[model samples]
Target chain A: MTGNTAPSQADARRTVISVDAMGGDAGPAVVVAGIAKSASKNPDIGFLLHGPAEELEPLVARRKTLKGRVEIRDARDVVTMEDKPSQVMRNGKGTSMWSALESVRSGEADGVVSCGNTGALMALSMLRLRKLPGVNRPAIAILWPSRNPQGFNVMLDVGADVRADAEDLLQYALMGTSYIRNSMDLPCPRVGLLNVGTEEHKGRAELKEAYALISQNAEKANFEFVGFVEGSDIPGDIADVIVTDGFTGNVAIKTGEGTASLLRSAIREAFEYSILSRLAALLAYTSLSRLAKRIDPRRVNGGVFLGLNGTVVKSHGGADATGVSAAVKLAFLLAEQGFAEKLAARVASAVELAQDDATSADADAPGDSETGSTN
Target chain B: MTGNTAPSQADARRTVISVDAMGGDAGPAVVVAGIAKSASKNPDIGFLLHGPAEELEPLVARRKTLKGRVEIRDARDVVTMEDKPSQVMRNGKGTSMWSALESVRSGEADGVVSCGNTGALMALSMLRLRKLPGVNRPAIAILWPSRNPQGFNVMLDVGADVRADAEDLLQYALMGTSYIRNSMDLPCPRVGLLNVGTEEHKGRAELKEAYALISQNAEKANFEFVGFVEGSDIPGDIADVIVTDGFTGNVAIKTGEGTASLLRSAIREAFEYSILSRLAALLAYTSLSRLAKRIDPRRVNGGVFLGLNGTVVKSHGGADATGVSAAVKLAFLLAEQGFAEKLAARVASAVELAQDDATSADADAPGDSETGSTN
Candidate 1:
């Protein structure tokens, strides 16, 4: 613990990530192997693996690269995939998910990673870590592969909450912008409110109000408001950050994932249909693999829980070693850059400005009850 | 005049589709060519072409197949794509879209087909044809290519209205069921309410109520209620009919289309990246084309306006001859089977049953205003 015997200041400040080793579709073995891969790749990375000691100790001991880099924290309970958020909130005290979040809450880990139930994890994180100051509703920001120069677009409220009013959308815009700026290092990220149509007059009344709010505050928030964008724009480079209600975003996420999965299977089916196709597939195997890697969900396996006091990355529940390692790498980058602190400060100031704008609008249009019902 | 020289009794009952041959992106040429293709393929099909006779005469004259099969109605006006629905409602007189809908209203045509503005087309159809009895909100139903045994699934409210209460969703279910049963020939189509998740207690409050209402009337409606379905189910075979609010449905449609388009281009790009890839692409050309045909949007190119007294199919504004032919083929099927009349009767009976259930629920739980607040 003393600084005198520390390897170096940089090594002393090495980012430690809390990982929930239990509860993923694949057992804790994959989690250990994933961490081992990350540790071997990045010497500065350290992990606080949370799970049953008896189960994780041997797995951790088996990996030489993960031996000195990993620390095991014992936790007996596990949150299954079927566990409800309400059930987890009521009695998930000794679960690895709870213990992992606790490590982040206690500042022992810069960020936490888990492949457990999303609803339960979000609920536990919200209850434990608490929302950052001035954050009305916490959002789950995900990096979607896109045609952007940055290779991905940030989308939020993917399932944090089902409803996002105009205010909530504005916060999502701000939060998504912060996440993209920090994670992707994109200055002045372009933000768009996801709607059915690109036209300002189309979509729900709340979207119109959100468009106005985002446009009016884009300058102050240090991001370019791309006005409104359709669903296709989510994967396009038209917007660096795509914001929407949790309901639409969640469905879009699943739909996009499902579509990619379906098409991949279809391509494979096409390749195996006949001997000629099989031969052609072999000839085109290298290009196909490159294309596959470009669209592989495992390469970008983390969904960062934004608006929280500390960063928490949710790895896919069925993530293998590669997927888990991708999530770990994401966590490492965010933790190394102190993304949570920067995002918190950005959101705190931006939210204050947004509140002022709301106050002024209320004073300007006191009789407009429709505007009053924006929240 | 029609029955005097008819080749047979079936020809005497020829299904006439009113065509708005103006204002589409490709102009009347595509419309004329599309109908010509349909007319050549189906001898029982007839067309009432609405547009400037001066412009139409030349285009129609070129297609010998359309000579006796098509009837040009002299209309000088055209409905531009940029025209708003409200604007069209006030002063759409003499317009091709208005004239086309009028043909259906006057029983001159079995169904109306237009490649003009969707908003304008829907407005004219709603105004001229009016909603069927007991129908609160009309919806637009489109056939989405899926992994179903039928190769397509019916998804309604693609962009009819931005909002849908629990009752509206139930109506969409009924109308969608009627449309699918008649069109796809499925006796008991599986209908699902689209939501953020498939879980019973998830999503918005309206969705929860919709789940209950839909479940309560599944047997009466003659369809299986598959509870909630996610966006993936739109293209999957899990649900034959996916019901959703217009906002979500429209976004999901566009997202799916956009994702498909992006991936298509990505595949092409991947193939042309190098000489080897280009050679492989050439070798795999046949299989690739087959896969492309499977996902071609043109194969199923019509969006039928449901819950109307008369059938109306809105072709894509940029439809080519193939797309237009597909839409005309759909209209012919609907008109030949008298789908509008059957759907109206089914909706009326279903709505009555739903109302009876609502009235009894109101009597039982008088204090539950949330259920009553549905639309």
Candidate 2:
């Protein structure tokens, strides 16, 4: 019903992100270390580390390096990997995950960054924050593993919706496009509907129709709908925002991640084979790191929930200290820019334009009184 | 209408596959060489070469190597990358692209394999060969780049459907599962729908619903639905057959291919960095190749157009001799196993199970339908 309340610069002293202190394999210590490091570098940025006070209290940095830049927001429960979404929502009440999001909702903090259960986060966000206007659904878009200079393309609904029609796609395109433009700061980003082929008739019947609507309406006049893009096309600097159902989106992103890992392992295996290969590995270490950095998803660890009323950054649950640091930093940017409201406004305008056309069509067919259908 | 045609092994003659004799960077000479090698290895195999009579004419191997195994099917046209799919289809009367697929559809040959224009092949095949029974759409399933002994995952709708919905997803699962069983000889392999997350409510609404339906039906039944698989899951032997809409599938495959190339280039750059690294490269070359072999999609180039009336393999348009050769070899295996007809029967059975439910839903007070509606 409402957009994220823009924090007044004068009223707010610092940008604070609620981080799940217990998240990641290395646990709260790594998270606190990352926060302390990030806070030390950016004096204006602060953090509310959420988790068991016992572990995090001792782990919290007490140095002038991060002086006046951090605080611990204690929570009793820890939402582990095996926890259900509903349990995270209902039972994990004063838990780090819930408190973090609530902090944002109550305007205690600028945003919430989590590396905990994704399903729990989505469920909680929907319940606490709620989707924005005209957003029948919210999509969690992350940077797809790619070769684009803009880093990686942002793909949404990675695993959000399973059964969606044309409307959801149109919304995702507009929302993703807006987020990239306002948050990621791209110019006239190309938006492509992920499909099997470039052909108009390819994909499911719904996709064919979605393609026609995207093409015909000239939706998001600011963004270019670069027609349909295939799986292979994703690596190219073709589309800034590639839209698809969450099923495909999730698979595509993971595929890239998997390949990167596979390549890394292969290179490692090659290096371990013999003394010569071992020598090459040592000699080529710098070059390999360079390549890894260029393709690293961790550098940009946070994925903003586009089309939502406020900012929520979903960091990798398997993230290290480096990833957690990046996620906190990204949240600062989104909140500072008031990106959510900007995206919501842009998305609202597009939906309105689309709705106008639909209303006129209904007006034209007043006599039939037929149900508005996709057939 | 028919179960697997029973591998025609009962008959004396082997199923023939007409390959693009003039296709690929290596040209007909390579095709001639590869065919000779295959025929010599498998005495039952036969080759139908399509190209200009002159180009297909003279060869040293023609007499000594492929003397009786190879047969030239004369055609005047060679479809280059520059040629449009429409142009290739229009000139099918004499072009290598058309003749390749037509030769199989006409029953002049058992099936067709082409390394030429993918768009041309897909267009011509759809135009010439009908989809198998109960197949609402035909999709291509490609192996995602992966390493390790289990091989990689099979992604459906690689270049088939651009957009997809619930029904399309169900069909892809059926066809992909059938492909694994009949062709690859994996009985009831794990089937996974690619998405952002594995939760019942993750990904797009369409995908979530699809996940629900699949997990309910495919979980403990004919196929194992492994809940949800992420993009990274494809390379780690999580599931044998991975299903997703075409958009994500295509992007995932391409991203894997491009990232692999990028990594490969980076590895080369690492080698050229210094004398020591060069030595390492030399020492590590064998191990690297072994790893590359595990991740090479080219080795698995042949992707069957599942749910098609006849067996057809669409090789990558940019494939070289080795890639095309792989596709040809795969097509041969499918033909030998009568994969297409058997897959069709499995798909038909699944559809039959859903028919009564589908009929009731459609026949009841119809909801607004978008069978062909666009956004």
Candidate 3:
């Protein structure tokens, strides 16, 4: 395991991230160019690029920045977006995505990064790396640009699975809190359960049950529980970690993205409507660029797979060079901090203790009302 | 009942809508001013203003346009935002919201419009107006400004209930299609079931079952079934009618609104960052305003409660005069066209047929696995 061979502080300064250099909407050229940008700026980072060597070699050779830091791994197949997850899982032995994950599994790379199909990537990761002990479900956590002091908030379970029971939601909170604490360096993150309304009586029965579980564990887990938060609070300052089932989180994120896209196109069309508006766009270019950078989804393009034995970052499918580079940077940060091992340890300890508590109560009641079972 | 009192085409030309002049965050002044604006523009519309006579009489007197078009109904109570739904339902006899709904109940007005507590309004609506026969649950339908040829798409069940079984979702699709057909004049609206992913196998068990139900009913119901759609399609052109349970719909809309607000504030701060940017803002004001008006939430302020015996439009709780006027205008249009009666009949006939199918199937197979129950 990488945990045993992680090396001394001096050797740990350098980290390797496996890259799936195929299957993204923007093509391998963008992925190669993106890694080159990250490798040039961060000398401590190296890549294990997986794809057809013929296609990737030319792209790598064209970029002076990628000179000795990139290692291309030849793979025979590519996973398309239309490929079913079950099909990919069964026939993906020689695929680039399979090779990329294999590097992480063998400890040849500290983490894996892919801009391929999200479902296929997640299915492969779960199959190869396996879920952490005591974890019923793994979640996908993303950073949303927010008005918080950290400039971003972590939202979790964004389409890993469509459902989360009370126990699954509590586990999501634990994993999310550990993630923000390790990556963002917050000592005690404030976690909020996502619901239809902020009122205590609102939302589904499972949410209300999840709220009680999360609240009970917040103090012991070293995070503050803010009870239930509405969808609007996802981008607000009330909570640093927003926890919900995959269904709500997935729909909310996509809806937010769609709205942002709508506004961007509208603003662009407005600036192109007249000559005076064109001049105004020119003058406001710098400020506009700065504003765009702050809210750009590309800047925070990575969605980390939590509760897995290994770390994996999934970039946007249509991400360009800049977006891919952002995902690479995120993988580097998580790898440097040993996020995967730390998260597993955190979840294992917390969940084990929770199970012990449930067991003791179960011994007394003998399966009366506790229903102590993993979802 | 409005179904019995609905007038002839000539009499319907002069429609009367009851306006709840209290309970909104903006106070009765905004409501009175809003009705005045609508009454001045449409000579065929009249208002039944529900509030304190002293408070509304002077506001109505100042507007010569409302001289003969408005009638004041004195109400001694006001329902505050802090009031619970159950509390309001039991003790809200003399409240403006109660008075407004009562007018519709007694066939004194063709419809009702209120910028009040959504939960209270819905509770009062269901209590006083009742649900249409054979309708399992009522849904709140809203107009989402979109890229459709009609320039808007209808989304339903925005917060009427947090839970929906497969049958409820199918009912939402049926009701939404009928709404778009009658209001937007779309002969055969394309209905899409909202899911975590567009793939058939994605999302929860209920969504999968709902997909099959909606698909089976499409041909018979006279609407195009677009299989499944993701949250991004809410603002996209693939579906003219987006149907989901109230929880997902509510969260998606609020998340969209919150994101738009974030971008709005960010753009404002960008323009105010420097004098040069302020000059650019000045030059871009005309173009910016045009874009703003196009996507303004106020332009689509009302949420109509479908599957009800009478039509009721719920405006934003904090809406100003412009927003309230928009709601009033929507109420006027629906009342003029007897939308409430038409929608009730459509739902009753369609649902009766669906229930018959369920009963015959149940009789044949007993409990084989239909789960034909409302949520």
Candidate 4:
């Protein structure tokens, strides 16, 4: 494990994370620094760093903590922020991002982390890792800072695919619950369906259908169903996991981020407006820093790809060393818990239960008027 | 003008705003106080306050500014917050909310303001005053605190309808631009179509069509079209008007609000963390208050209903005196500017232009291959 000769089966305690060294806005130096930070904190972690060896070798050599724990995989190509998902899928095989995923694909690494183009990362992930059994759409789930006792709430389908049907949303719920149970150790998390209003007769036709479907499967799935939740509930204590289609979830999270960014700048501007305030800011520096740490986006930087055959964490493209380190930490935790296998098993059983429920309903009443209308 | 006897044509200087006094959660007293605040600020404003006369008479009698400027219109019933929009439309004729809208419908008032259930208010508004000619669905537009020089950016379809097609989004751009021009005094507002990404090929099918349609109509409509914008650009300086379907728009705004609220409370908690911080809070009071004033939701409480025959301002149901006053001020300003009629004319001409363009396109290329794919 210390030598990093690709952690053997005997050194199962060492969690090897394959990282795309060339994907981030910051260069491979930052990626090396991030892994070094993780290595310094956790002695059981190792890395398979991917990039052009000539460029990454110096960066890795500079980090003392990463000396014996890192193995560099040379790949000449790099995927930029401008690359499209379609283009990446067709021509990205030569890139470091592809090489990094290959390490996980071949079971050389427990998980993969990349601060690359989100679209490209998700596309390559789905193409290489494939979807789990009975899972139609794989979702990207992020932990939002919240008022909950856990300090965060899970939101899914942030931008994986813009559209999610009723069945797809139900699957997100199951996968989200499994992720939360494994990651946060919540055995029976409260799940809420994101909607315009909490009423029984609110939102789009698909949401109504999703409501009935998720509700019917809640008890069998071992989770409590909080029927409908508004956008405000994303950071609220009302639910542990909030589910929605990718488009709405993406917009909501971005809007929340933008608003928080705006307010933070405003707070700084206020403290700088007058001499009295400037003095006050100096006096309150320690308290303000604590508050900042609590809401810092860098602390919760990873977006976990759910329902995939292997675990892949997407770090923000513009992430710095701290952001990248947080993502690596998340990936390591998931990999250590064997999250991918557990999620796959959870979704497979849920699909079986759903088919059984449909069969029982058909046998009991062929013309069951209780079935949700497509409209 | 000062007496408010339902001002005649000769007394056109008086701008009468119909108020639904019974709809607010705080009751008619707060409504009276709110109108009094508006009356004290503007001399030419008047109100037709609708509620039970016995309950409203004493409240109006206590305010010197509202004495002669306010006229009470007795309506026996109130539209409760829990009532369904459908139920209110059928049995709300006797409610003060209906009477308030009737004043605008009969041209006795220039605009209407109500602190009631939003769905019921919108439903009764469409049923009473009807949609403007050539308008398909009416939208609710609200001003958001932003990085713009104007201090705010407009976002529409906040919750008026859960669905909006490509054509509906085009209308939102047209109407939103008009509202900004009349309210914010921006002659050529920059409009951006909200989507998951700024790229042309991103987002749902309707958004792509909307992007093309909005781009095509920009120059003719005298507004600068800034292609596609993400949710972050709603509060960003990149766009003055951000357009999207109601479901997405509603979720984005609420998420922003919730995030802001969470951060504000966190700020308060941070200041209360230590003795030094408590002293700093006292010293930074004025500066913090200034920042609070700039981002306070009460100052921008009203959500203006667009594309209607008459302007309707929906205040928060739980608005206090200050919140109600802000709504009243917005209604007064729009009423004085004759926003409804001007908007109707603008929309009418835009529809004609769209039709003419469609006809010309059909003639120019009988087998045009440039049409958007419905898939």
Candidate 5:
């Protein structure tokens, strides 16, 4: 319906998403197709497609919907999936991922999307857009299909860094809350610190400290702390946001994905087991398809890089057109909501609040300040 | 059938499994029903059912198959799920869980099966049976249904302890191999160190050290080292044994279970969405049941405690009769194969071999010995 709006008005207000066209396993054509899909769906969406102009220009030209809505930024080098993050940081100046991020850093694009090497992309994004002040570690937050009313829960630190301490975990809780508020449109998200058990006394020492820190700051950060939640709670309706160190979060997400894939295959095998089952499969085709669409990984392809100066959605490297389109859709939504800037402001204020609390406590117990420093 | 074997001969060589009948969410009735199911299937199986005698006697008496197979051990105190592991270790002497482990400690039972509080059972087991000579940490290994020929993969350190160093990880690999050998009849299992990425340099410092340590000892330990595996590979056919620290493993397994459950419910909802789907479900009943049977968590219900003096299978605290029976079957099979003694011997020899390698290397380069010791 918005497509019927005046062309000049839509063009003037178009939200431009910078994309690394050459980063994905499917290459530039798929990326172009994805943007075309977004362009067809939303009149106010535009793209700054980054890749070798010689390769990407033809792909963009082939997509009718992207006729005047796309601009190709010529970046010759491609950051392959095999490139190490450290290596990419040093020699990644000319890569499409770097160039795409440069658009966001230079204020030419609202948000960036890339189906590149995750580590390399994160490294370049940090190098270009930079980390938010007072943020120790930027986290990769993904939407997990869940039993929540919103149909998904936010899980953070899915692999920005392998380790997170008490302070870093507190930052994640704040960043995760910001992510849910902007992206999911929840005013006050329920945040749960991931652990082996929900009990206060269970899990590692760092988790206990983090639990206390997160609990203390929850009200100030405008989120409800759900205390400790186990891995089983990730897909449950108990919490809208699950926070953990990247190592544990990474393993959890991958394990969840693997298990879901295994079950999907097993279900297909079940339906194809016999002639009667095959007939049943035909009869239940629409229902099964609806279910598949609901749980499709492609539908939730973006992993938003949080605690950064700008929004970046890292699409799955193996993502096809549909997956890439989903990622672009996510980037557009976040950009439209001004998610990155709002998150930066939220984190800045939270950090100030934390410091203020610490300072006041120190002033109140000047003699015991030395003992408090042990924490 | 084995049930037709001479009752006197069967009684002479019966494998007695100590069970904490008062444990489990479903209470003593489910535990009794579980052992009864196992007793019916295996003529050479006997149970040392530990609980309040007056309470358990009537439950066991109702099952005709368990009439001559079960011996009720009166232990007044029941270790509820709320009891802390530390508290249990101090005052758990007269509890049913304690009495169950005592049977194994005193050699009255071949192995112990308990659907009790995991922390309590593990703490009591460690206190009573003690750790094996070479093991720094005892791990809880569970059979994860996978694409492996054996139908499952063995994952260790699934909540026995929250942390594991390089040496502890190596020990898990060794213990995991031993478990596969005895339980799944794999002569030399392929072991993979679980990490965020399969790449050699992609994880934490301890994991990298563990990778090198595991790879070096793989040949000597008589198992194939698959280097590193991501969480996705846990359910894949790439390796038979996946080892990690308890924190990650605990999160991973639980996440996998949660995801599977979410999918199962989604599938059920899909089938019940409309009249056509409901009709399809009716037609595909047998095929769907077969698939359900294949991936049923109840069929693989036990988490085996490894690197201990005696075998203990911690059945799910919420296990029903079928789940309990599955655990009992696992315990009986392990007991019949003398798994505990075999695992101890294997671990001891592996430790000696590692020591031998270190000693020889130290002798070869005395100057560099100090640096090697730094590991």
Candidate 6:
């Protein structure tokens, strides 16, 4: 086992990140702010903002003091968050988001990050970029907001493959584990299966089968397989990675965001209604703000689409300047660290752990079980 | 349209509610306590317990002088929460919970309640009682604790059918609306499809069709069909009834429950171990307690399986007497208000609204698009 390898990975950084310029309500403004901040701080980094050159001129003009690390590429249309992805994929060749993804696929950009239409990005990336060998349907791995000292946990298949079979779930666990250990650099990163209960026998039939396969996998033995974790555990880092169906993961994370939002609004709305309450709220402002910041979504900006052939990071459609900045940094870090190859290797190693169970005829022949040696 | 028949739909049982004697943890004890509390002030209401002779004897002996129109029935064996649903239906011939359901089915009991296995009650109820004519799948509906004076906004299909198409979602929306409109007695319950975003085209293809169908079904307009709602809106009562796939719904509710548990632990752990922090905790006790109560899962017991042929309420697996009592009230309300029949008509009327869209062909679909549903 290659136990330690960070120096060699960090040295690889002719890395260029492609940002979707026309994405988000804030438009190129926030994306520009984020890219400007990233480029100003990191001398070695470079970025290609893909969108209309005319529109980009005004945004880039404001950042005149920016160093030579920035450039712009023009493209025609923009994919709104509300566009039908199926139709978009067929006809949106002119979209800058599409062009940005093309740059990554063609090896012009090391990675692509977008703050607009997550559904469109995932569909286009998987279609144009394709899935890695031994990877099934590419899952959208999103990092949850966290206040814990351990930081964010990557929740997989947030929307990539919604209705997952047992094998699909197992693959998610494998890929998620690799992403955490390789990209996040956690030692023997802990893996937790999200479930309604902690009991091994709990949950659906598919979940039960997946649990057995993951639990019994000898390759997974190196990592701390922490068993079942409930929803809130995702934020708490009870495990470094939480595996779930895309539907649930999406709902849970959005729910967390919504809950935090509602709480903040409730407090604000409460204070807004009365003078006495406003005075009390003023007194409580410091602690409330501290608590709000503790659960703030912006600090953790992007969620990586793991198991894809190349790196793709998706920022929340509603992300602001700070959030977009964090996403850019995340993309850079992933590129510099060469987490893809490392994660792929680690995940490939994990597949070997289930060989005993795989000896049973049907197991070895299905899905992404085709070996790298098959080549 | 029966546009103004709300008052006649009010529950018939103006006084006490009869509960399943052998339901939930601390069956008689907690039920006895709940009965005591609910009945203490009302005085006119009563609680009827149904269970095995021996179990009721101890509770009957212990309560001594407790009131609320307490009554008992003889039964045997418990339908455990962990039992396979098939076993509960086929083999639990003599179980107390089953017998209680039979009572409700027979109209001998005003309602039946059990904290035993959810899948079991749902299956058995359908097996024995079947569904309301237009209802293909039964939905489990419960109130999520809310901040508003209304207490909770109803969330349907907590875990009824693990896989459901858009038709099922429509059914949930319609049935849940009827419960809110006729039973819970809300005026024009706003229906929202639970999803990842509020954008028009933000979900799987199945949901897109469901959204279109919901929008197109403008005739009967069972309730004002609000467009997509995300997870964050659930606690905020963004709509009176929120609908989604049971799989995601179940996961979301469990996530919320698990989150509340984790937060409680976090609050305790954060404050415990030191003197000044302990003092701070004491100062914040009331506010913290209010938060705890607001998120308490147990306070609202049983999730009703709406659209079933007959009324069946699934109590939380870990429910105590309090939960059991709540389940009883839910069941009683359903029975007293003729909830199922009203729901059946509402569903039939809703089907009429979407007659051209086709409910039968698209029922219980698992994110499959051909039939038009995937959440």
Please report the candidate that would top lDDT against the real structure. 4
Quote the lDDT for B86 in model 4.
Answer: 100
Best to worst by DockQ, what's the order? 5, 4, 3, 1, 2, 6
Model 2 chain B is weakest, by summed lDDT over 10 consecutive residues, at B366-375
lDDT score of residue B211 within candidate 1: 94
Worst 10 residues of 4 chain A by lDDT: A366-375
> Residue A144 of candidate 3: its Cα lDDT?
86
Query: Which interface RMSD values do the candidates have, in the order shown?
Result: 1.4, 3.3, 1.2, 1.0, 1.1, 4.2
TM-score (C-alpha) between model 4 and the true structure: 0.94
Is 1 or 6 the stronger prediction by DockQ? Answer: 1
Evaluated on CA atoms against the true complex, candidate 6 attains a DockQ of 0.25
TM-score of chain A of each: 0.91, 0.88, 0.92, 0.93, 0.93, 0.85
Each candidate: chain B TM-score: 0.92, 0.85, 0.91, 0.93, 0.93, 0.82
Residues A1-375, model 6: lDDT tens digits? 011122114335546888898878788888888888876777666777888888876787788534445567788799997787787789888998998898888877788889878778888887898877667767888776443455567788787765677777777877787676655656666778887656676677888887876776523345567888777577665788788888788888766665555555544564455565555445554444555565566888788888777888898778887888888888888887777666666556555535534665554445434332211
Cα lDDT, model 6, residue B124: 81
> What level of docking quality does candidate 2 show?
acceptable
Return the interface RMSD of model 6. 4.2
Each prediction's whole-model lDDT (CA)? 0.84, 0.70, 0.85, 0.87, 0.87, 0.68
Residue range A83-107, candidate 1, lDDT tens digits = 8999999999989999999989998
Model 1 clash pairs are none
- What is candidate 2's TM-score for chain B alone? 0.85
In model 5, the runs with Cα more than 4 Å from the true position are A1-10, A361-375, B1-10, B361-375
Better of 2 and 3 by TM-score: 3
lDDT of 4 by residue, B216-288 (tens): 8787778899999988899899999999999999999988988888898898898898888888778777877
Task: Provide TM-scores for the models.
Answer: 0.91, 0.78, 0.91, 0.94, 0.94, 0.80
The predicted structure with the larger DockQ, 5 or 6, is 5
DockQ (Cα-based) for each candidate? 0.52, 0.37, 0.58, 0.65, 0.65, 0.25
Q: Answer with 4 or 5, whichever has the higher lDDT.
A: 4
Sliding window of 10 residues with minimal summed lDDT for model 1 chain A: A1-10
